[model samples]
Target: MPATRRSSLAIAAALLAVAANTAPALAASAPAVPNAPMIPSGSAPHLVGPHGEILHSSSSNWSGYATTGAKFTSVSASWVQPTATCDGNDSYSSFWVGLDGDGSDSVEQTGTEVDCSEGSPLYSSWYEMYPAYPVNFNDAVRPGDHFTASVTAGDGGSFTLKLSDTTQGWSHTVKKTLSNAALASAEIIAEAPSDASGPLPLTNFGTVDFTGAKVNDKPLGSFNPDNITMATNGSTLATTSPITDSKDFSVSWKRSS
Candidate 1:
């Protein structure tokens, strides 16, 4: 499938899910807002290798590494939440690890978010079974907090998503089921959050470093994942560094939108 269409479908599914769960009065009072759902922006072509592996790709909303061409049962990563620099314009960003949503519709993911709201940085954490609205965690998230997250698919479509903040001493584990999940991809990414309209402006997160990234109990680099850069309208918004030691990399922000 074309990259643009794949991304659009993901966002559309999330919107439908949100609409279904909203009450008429609430829906009328305010539009449903997504909590840092991943929405690839722009229409960059995916460069495929001779072995059907994605070599490199670009997205308007995502930057980092994603491994495809396999059924991913587990994915995990750790990072320190990057601080966001706020300005007059509102912007949003997230750091996450997940399975699927690269070549298929469903994504089982959990992560933290830093958003510029009214010129101030707001930090939060959440998990989402894509096509379903994200559920926010009430625990506080702060810049520089060390966070570890993982997602595992179990028998009969059961799935477990976990996120923890070592700095704050809080953790959450959620169990959900998605019988038709494709489990097609695994990713460790930094992203610009989206809403029904489209991707929101990316927050100026400076940089976030991810370590111990693994998929299926092996280092993420073992699969030679695609190196993804975030861009829009020919402008580079964020860049991903080469993975070091098969498990470490960083995504640096260059622009807000």
Candidate 2:
């Protein structure tokens, strides 16, 4: 998982959990899957311009805006669920808002996912307190659903992760604890989700538009965020747009890699 440094114990536990159940509680909906891990493939190297402007950065699995250099307490964003165009290949993507994944080990995050399996598309939602496995919500998720999500850090290693699909009339709230969380950065991202092996191919999720992006109750751009482009082996997989109104932006899928 990209910023989630899972321990051997966590991996073993996740595998056991999956082995214990051949099927999820509901057959018609997505199972309580845990494979979407944010494992950082590589450090995002920051590029600064001559005038000291934050130019851009690149990651293997992440594309969006991440702000560091401050102790961030909260991050929030809203986006319409993107429709995934599936082929025969298995691919995965997620849209989310999170904290502590830029330079730190843990990520407290929640959002939605679109995955391709056997030429079909699966839409679901989930949250992860990294190092631990992600827990998928059973709520029905469809393309074009309006979603809002946030991660807020409280005192004493406590945190709240919330995701709401207004288009579907449902919401999920999770409270977790990460005693060593860095609170180092906040981000709104579109990601190519990963598993134990490494990053999976990105789904063709056309474009996801993010709005009302905020960190610590202020516009995200106020902190000078890094615009991340997702690439691997010099091949672009996704690209993030420049932030406008200090709050809105979009991420477009480029290739499956």
TM-score for all models, in order of appearance? 0.85, 0.85
Q: What count of clashes does model 1 give?
A: 0
- Model 2: per-residue Cα lDDT at residue 165: 90
Candidate 2 ranges with C-alpha deviation above 4 Å: 1-45, 49-54
Superposition TM-score, candidate 2 onto the true structure: 0.85
What TM-score number comes out for model 1?
0.85
Residue 248 displacement in candidate 2 (angstroms): 0.2
Backbone atom clashes (below 3 Å) for every candidate: 0, 7
Q: Clashing residue pairs in candidate 2, if any?
A: 1-37, 1-38, 1-39, 2-38, 2-39, 2-40, 3-38
lDDT of 2 by residue, 19-74 (tens): 35423211113323333323343546668966575668888888889887779999
Tens-digit lDDT track for model 1 on 144-219? 8899999999999999999999998999999999999998899999987666455668889999999999999999
